[model samples]
Target chain A: MSKHLLIVSTSTVYGKGYLGYMEEEIKNFFGENKNIVFIPYARPGGISHDEYTEIARKKFEELGLSVKGIHEFENPKKAIAEADGFFTGGGNTYVLLKQLYENGLIEPLRNAVENGKPYMGTSAGSNITGLSICTTNDMPIVYPPSFKALQLVPFNINPHYLDPNPDSKHMGETRETRIKEFHFFNDQPVVGIREGSWLEVMGEDVTLCGELSARIFEQGKEPYEVPTGSKIKF
Target chain B: MSKHLLIVSTSTVYGKGYLGYMEEEIKNFFGENKNIVFIPYARPGGISHDEYTEIARKKFEELGLSVKGIHEFENPKKAIAEADGFFTGGGNTYVLLKQLYENGLIEPLRNAVENGKPYMGTSAGSNITGLSICTTNDMPIVYPPSFKALQLVPFNINPHYLDPNPDSKHMGETRETRIKEFHFFNDQPVVGIREGSWLEVMGEDVTLCGELSARIFEQGKEPYEVPTGSKIKF
Candidate 1:
């Protein structure tokens, strides 16, 4: 079976509850699956692993799905292999990848997702689905052995991507400028998934989901905005 | 002899010419040094090394200083060691560190600065003056051999740091939140140098420079603002 993924841009959009906007779609995405192996390695606000897992569990329980953190298992690799579905929450990408590498769960997680076990990721979790975490917006709090990631998708995912505010006085590089710099070093295409937007990956198709449009960056070409519900072709 | 470093937060503040804000201070910082080697590996906007260097050269010429690009030298390590002073312009920190390591210029540059030679950096350039580039705001467009930097200073520096806008609708983590997440993994104290402000290092003293207050983030302590010209401790 081909891969199925829900790559969410963020866990909570502005003024929304945690994972609120995509709850219904997420529930239907893993229909009949009652238990999800939660990867709380990202740990937003530096919350404890158990605390982060509990937040995810509470959200999933509302949809009749129980959640268990990968850390709760003695063997994380085995836990991912036997998991009915997976939910990777967002926080810091560097720390999450570091733990993923240290636990030797990269291959097992990839295999599970490739074998049709549904997988959903928000922010840093969604970032891991790309070829590398080079485009992440998080601080490099920790360093992983490699920038290479799970390669679940053909392009890079820049979660929670925002457009530059024209009225702002800050002089930092804009999101568009940063992505263009990425093109300078790599040839991979990048998808700038905006807030409340996500990539819904079915067997062989990836569709842009949500109300807002997403930006697509290709090397040596102008980045263009694509409407929501549009299919993405790498 | 102790090092003399000028760690600027940005090359050009908004609506200012390149290096315009600190030109006179930079001139006095060098104190009759006629030649300065320029490291343009950061290459903002993905410009070529020569193009980036010329921009620096033009700015320095106004101060009656001669400039040479490190890339133009046959032996980059030798060029760094023989230079009267050093100037690292800002761009992508990853690309800058990668080149520094790849060309074996890290040790040479560090030695020159530690030996009391004047060295200046802006944005990504200044980020390297700290223990590591972990706190940079730039995108990781490329992977470097290591995240280790010059270690010219004990703590890490967060360049172009901006406070969160209370009225904004953006959902991304604020700079302060990102740095706090950094503290969860590492114990290094981080200095958030905002635009138009910089750190002046002479001998063993490090003082906040310019007209604005800089934010300081220490482990387990609330971030405090240090006024201009105040000496920083811890």
Candidate 2:
């Protein structure tokens, strides 16, 4: 496994506004050979494979990066071994995890990444890289046999977060409060990632991408916000 | 503090509806007169103090339990300290946790429960008894200075569950799948309390209630469900 990696937020769809810094980071990570053995199979949000593959294909074309075959390998064994690096796309993280776990691909992917194969997870893809898939907001539209995630990353990641809703009179519990409640019972950090941002990890060190500001929470301390340009080491 | 505690799921409206079994449990834990104090101060979900207090007053009336005036004390310090046992009501858990944290009632409540005060957290009330306050589906209509909860229950609880969406197309993650995904980052169990169902904890042991079922999850295992008659040890 190669140590270089990039977990994207979402692959551009026909060139809307670009996630400038994040796109640049991907280029920087891969450097000269931006070409990748793209695996778009993780688009498990009930989206059709054609549409999902097209999203990635367009990105590579638009970004001026070299195109590689979009692998349609259905089984995990074939897909995991033949790849140099992997980039799983975003959609329904539950679906992504379900496919990976059901096919027994989680460990294989982990091994591939550990041995230095560059593994990049985007959105739903990014969700599976974590130790538990608990942080995702993706609705489980379908039912899988079990509820387990690829236990790779040590902490849970909450992607695409805005601040707490201020005006909804529900005053009930907000998503933030709910997550905080999770921390109260269990001591684990749930990384709240804003749009256009993703986590880049090498070995154990993880860096915040795109936006410098993100909120990090553990169980015992006060909930603090990460300021722009601050170095967050975990 | 009494060791035997009976946490009611509701007072009426939703009674969260199981006063009869709860009464039996309360009596089973200690005799009927366990010196119960109504901790109505935790209904934090955006309701005005007057509205919350009214709900408290009503719960008191229907449950036939005297209101010990925890909310009226003005000082959480005096009220929480004076109370020997507690009965938390159901409402918006985020609001309840916010009020509890803002008023500095969390510590007192934690102490009382940990020291064996027979803490009974129902619905929103039960949610606060856990670690943090982020697992709820309720909106955060209000903001207190902090996001903290009384660290009593081990996992985040989602009380008052009904039917699932009828027309849903997303795959892999069902309503249940999404909550299980939350467990990836949060190791504490996510207890799904379907109406009359609840969790009855005594010392090191805990039991499930209601004729319905509850869902619980840990790190590595699948999200397994427990029915009304199940006894789960967390």
Candidate 3:
């Protein structure tokens, strides 16, 4: 048993139905694991866990899989241990991580995933698979006990990575600039995945998927891009 | 003596020299308080405190004020108590707040401002004058001890607030959506100040300054805009 994860930048791409853009890949990733424990901690739009879980359940059902929200279980830790697969949806990363910590599911879920329980995450979900949630673009609507995340990957994930708009008049720090600031105090490498792109990790191997090139920011190095299908070697 | 503060959305508006756009207002806000202590903890672009202070010193020098970085003092608390005024330049809010806590400056600075120290803040600086840094637009590269801030105003300030672009194909949550998510977990009202705009606070009175309108988001109420110079009552 080895690590198997599908870390997605977004659950829904612009103009695409929920998970429609990655339907083929998702189906392939789940394979025969039909019972997915949906971690709806990252409730996008602040929807309830049950409501967010239903969105994932309906989408997974179309692919012949059954989904259940982790909150629906009597014991979330036990639920993680017994689940055949996992799917964490996107929302506010801080809220999701806070709930995960509060439920004490971080270790259980990490153990399950490390033992080859299939895991899929989009945006905020994808963020936790990294070293820490420090690079996430989501607001700190809530505070997690720690920025430390499940070390499923050696690097951090910056979801929804946007290129600088040279024509814009906005003074907000660009995604690249923000990451640069992170490197000032942090030493971890950050993989910035754009919309419609994802990282497919099988055991020790991690590769960039989808049609777009992903940006890589390493501490003390100039940020660069790795084309689709390239191995993300930090 | 009364609460006197200048909370700005951004330190520099697009196409304007740093502090150039609000020279008159900044001068008026400072009045005859010429000796200023600058908090460079935000450290935009990861510059050292001394380097960041140099930037502010040069800018304020144009206005006939002598600026010194707080880091220069052996006792920061004493520096706050003895300074004629204060100016906190913008960078990363988490970093700023974290350093403030690390140095035990939050209480001193808040008390100083409450006693009419003529405090001015741009971006991250402006954010701390509010109830919490939960509504900031900066990345949480570093975790502060707490999200609690100066509470100079009753509401949170979402500095560098941008309106949703109807034409955007990107799926990231808009500023409005993010603030809405914030309300789901916290009850504090949020003031979304755009670039070139600021809030002028005199005692308990807070009025929107600059030429642009500011958006206000209150829990359970739809976000609405109040024109420039309008008293932000909600």
Candidate 4:
């Protein structure tokens, strides 16, 4: 049993239906894991856990898998230990991480995933699989106990990463600028995954998937782009 | 002696020099308070404290006020206590608040502003005047002891607020969507101030300043627009 994870930048890309862009990848990643537990903690639009879970349930059902919301379980930790696979949807990272900590599911989920239970996450969900949730673009609507996240991966992930629009007059810090600021106080490497991009992790091996290249930022070096299908070294 | 504060959305608007757009307001707010302490902890682009202070020094110099970085003082608490006024420049809000807490300056600075020393903040600076830093747009580059802020105002401030761009195909959450999510967990009212807009706080009066209208979001209610010069009631 080795680690298996599909860390996605977003659940849906522009002009695509929910999880439509990655239907093939989702099918291949989960492979025969029929009983999937959905972690809907990152409730987009501030919807209830049950509502968010239904969205994932329908999508997973289309893939011939049965989905149950983790919130629906009598004991979430016990559910995680018994589930064959997991799918965490996208929403506010602060809310998601906070709920994860409050429910005492961080260690249980981390243990399950590390012990070869397949896990898939998108957006805020994908962000939590990293070293910390510091690079997430979601607002800190709620403060989590700590910024520490399940270190499923060695570095942090910046999901839905966008390049600076040179033509815009907006003065807000661009994604690149934000990551540079993170480097000032942090020493972790961050992978900036664009929409439709994801990281495929199999045991100790992690590779960039989808058609776009990822921008890599290290503490003291210039950010560079790693092409699709390349191993995410560092 | 009243609460004299200038909470601005941005330091530099497009096509304007740093602090140039609000030159008149800055002068009027400070009003003969010649000795000002500068909080440069929010170090934009990871610049050194001295370098960040130099930028503020030159700008305030043009306004006929001498500025010194709070870091230059032997005791930061004492510095805040004695300065006639203060100016905190725009950068990462998390960094600013973290440094403030680490140096034990939150209480002293809050006391100074509450006791009639004129205080001004742009972007991240403006954010600290709010109830909490949970609404800030900056990355959590550094974690502070708490999300609690100066609490100089009853509500939260969303500085450099941008409306949704209808023409864009990007999949990221808009500023409006982000604020809506914030209301899901937090009860504080949020003032979404545009780049050129600011709040003028005088004692118990908190009025919307500048030419643009601000979008106000309260928990469980539809967000609405309040025009310039209007008092931000709730």
Candidate 5:
């Protein structure tokens, strides 16, 4: 059976508080699994791991679900394997993957999620669920051993994906252009998960969640949008 | 003496043809240096090296200069060493650096620039002139051997640097926040070179050229804007 995963594009939507929009969804998703191990490896804006974990702690506290930071454990690998559920917050994807590899928690985390444990991720966390982090929007502040990430999903995820702004005068490559470039070197499909959108994966049933449609790009195929509630098998 | 380097933030500005806005400046900078070796490894949008080179060739031809792609030569190292001047166009910084390392051209290119050979770069090209490509806006399509760049300048360069759009609904990290995250793991200064801005390095003097001001970011110091034509010693 496939793992139970909720890969959110972003924790906070525009003008929304931290995980505010999905509070009810999160509460329902965790269900009776109150012991959620929080992984805050992707430190956004250079925030300390403890500080980042605190943000998640406060959010889950309101839901009456206890959250423990992965860093609080003596061995992160063991902690991930024994955790009842997992919730990895968003930040810098590169840093997140780097720490995961460093702590040797990649396999343990993968096993935990694959064994039917509840797993939830947002932004950088969702990025790691993909095949690799080549599709991430974060800067490479630190070099990981490799760009390889957890292969929970068959394809890659580009979180917080935005369409090209026609009004903007900037000439930088758009999100579409970047994904196209990724196809040049990689054959994997890329799902452009827009903010406020997410993927709900439960035992081979991968449904697009939220109000917005997600864009999907496959190798040698034209990019197309899939509406919310559509099953994304790939 | 240092080299003659025109590190442009981008090759093309909005509403302008490719390299159109700075044609005159490029012509003046090249002067009588007709034989320009072009490095097209950046390959924007999966464009072939030959195709990218053709674009540069057409532009330089109009400026009364000859251009040759580095890939056309058997020995890319010798090409860099023997060229009168060099021009690396913008594309994907990761791919550009990867190719440089693969072809063993980084050291030779650095030597050529340090030996007073004229060098002009736009976008990804300018990114390589910095100490590292940590502040680049490009997606990491490939894993480079290292993030270490040509190091022509003592600081890192963030080409096509954009300020946060006040009206936009996007909640993604701004250019400033991204650069700040870079500082969390790195200590080198970063120059946010805006669109249309170019840095002219003649010997030890680094003057910010073009019409708009550039933002300078140091680890501990507040990121401040430098007026156009101001010298950036750091």
Candidate 6:
């Protein structure tokens, strides 16, 4: 039987060590289930699966959760099928997309989700939840010459949102400005997921989670925030 | 023989609209030489060649630089070879990569520069000068599912460096903080190109240009600013 789909967003893991809140969030998804099928192969720029998976194993164990190491699986397709709902740990989302594309796992994951698996995405993982993966914070880790993401959600996800940097010199333009620039070139609504915050979608219902709020920006209007447990509507 | 390569960085364009500056710059490049072959096909991502060329034509005319018209070339490789040195105006650097990659112009353009033909990337154009095209504000307009840019420079570039947004919730995390997130994952230094400032490469020398200063950030240390015309070691 297909399990619930859980996607751990890309930004939730190890961002400058800023993602300290990740374990609690991950546990929320895991709940009573101790064995998490770990996918630590998302780190880009030649990060070995062993490196990220071991890191995840340690972190999950530290959280008192048993980890079923899935990074060892060469074919993510079959591996994905064998697992319950999967947990996508965070890292460079672009790198993750590159892997998904290179390995051709996008369709398989979608199929599994449609088959009724619970999904949780953190940071970059969360980024892939949107309609277009264009809103991620991942530096085009590797240039396939363009940006391509797993379109799980119907909107773009911007992870790790926080207050602006004090020392920044780009006047009137914050990361918000940057995403607005992204919107200017396109017509997609961007979902800005701040640190400690995420949007959880279960069945037809989407709820926001975390300490801060998630902001959604559309054309010719102000960016508004979606409070925790609130459904994001276009 | 080929006249001196005239490249205009996007500092002027992305800001207050610079038809006059662009016209003057073009004049400086092709003084008395009406044989100037114009190319404005580098703005990538579903941006029609006609639309891209139209922007160039309109801007040149508005700035008073007399020009016949922009050459609408779909195949950048053929356009690049048959034409003189190229001029990459700014918009979306990642989008530019899409067009360049689809039309197979990356290697040919690199070869052209290697053979001593002038190549300039303004804004997004200037952005392509770096190792990858992840630097620009252009979101993925289309889904070729790649961001591999023409690595003309050794480091990464951040264009349209605007100041932080005061109302933003991302506290303690300025643009530097956000970019710092990238540093946590990779070892590359991000060059924040403030408006009016640019990095120019001639032969073996890569120098900064413009009236505004730039910020350079690595993983461990605090970010630093590089004055105009300064040569960055990293």
State the C-alpha lDDT per candidate.
0.92, 0.59, 0.93, 0.93, 0.92, 0.61
> Chain B vs. true chain B: TM-score for each candidate?
0.98, 0.78, 0.99, 0.98, 0.98, 0.77
In terms of lDDT, the poorest run of 10 residues in model 5 chain A is A75-84
Residue runs of model 1 more than 4 Å from their true location after superposition: none
DockQ-best of 2 and 4: 4
Candidate 4 has which clashing residue pairs, if any?
Answer: none
Report the lDDT tens digits of candidate 4 across residue range A33-144.
Answer: 9899999999999999989888888888998888999999999998898899999999999999999999999999999999999999999999999999999998888989
Docking quality band of candidate 6, CAPRI definitions = acceptable
Residue B153's lDDT in candidate 2: 60
lDDT of 2 by residue, B108-169 (tens): 77777777766766666776666656555443333334444666666666655434545532
Best of the two (1, 2) by DockQ: 1
**Best candidate per DockQ, number?**
4
Clash number for candidate 3: 0
Question: Which is superior by TM-score, 2 or 4?
Answer: 4
The CAPRI classification for model 4 reads as high
Two-way lDDT contest, 4 vs 5, winner = 4
DockQ of 2: 0.05
lDDT tens digits, residues B75-162, model 4?
Answer: 9998898899999998999999999999999999999899999989999999999999989999998888899999999999999999
Q: Indicate the DockQ of the complex predicted as candidate 3.
A: 0.84
Could you give candidate 6's per-residue lDDT for residues B85-166 as a string of tens digits?
Answer: 5566666555566666776767887777666655655667766766666655555555543555566666777776655766
Looking at model 1 chain B, report the run of 10 residues with the lowest lDDT sum.
Answer: B163-172
Question: What TM-score, computed on C-alpha atoms, does each candidate reach?
Answer: 0.99, 0.52, 0.99, 0.99, 0.98, 0.70
* lDDT (Cα, tens digit) per residue for candidate 5, span B171-212: 789999999999999999999999999999997789999989
lDDT of 3 by residue, A164-213 (tens): 98888999999999999999999999999999999999999999999799
Candidate 1, residues B66-97, lDDT tens digits: the string is 99999999999888777999999999999999
Worst 10 residues of 4 chain A by lDDT: A50-59
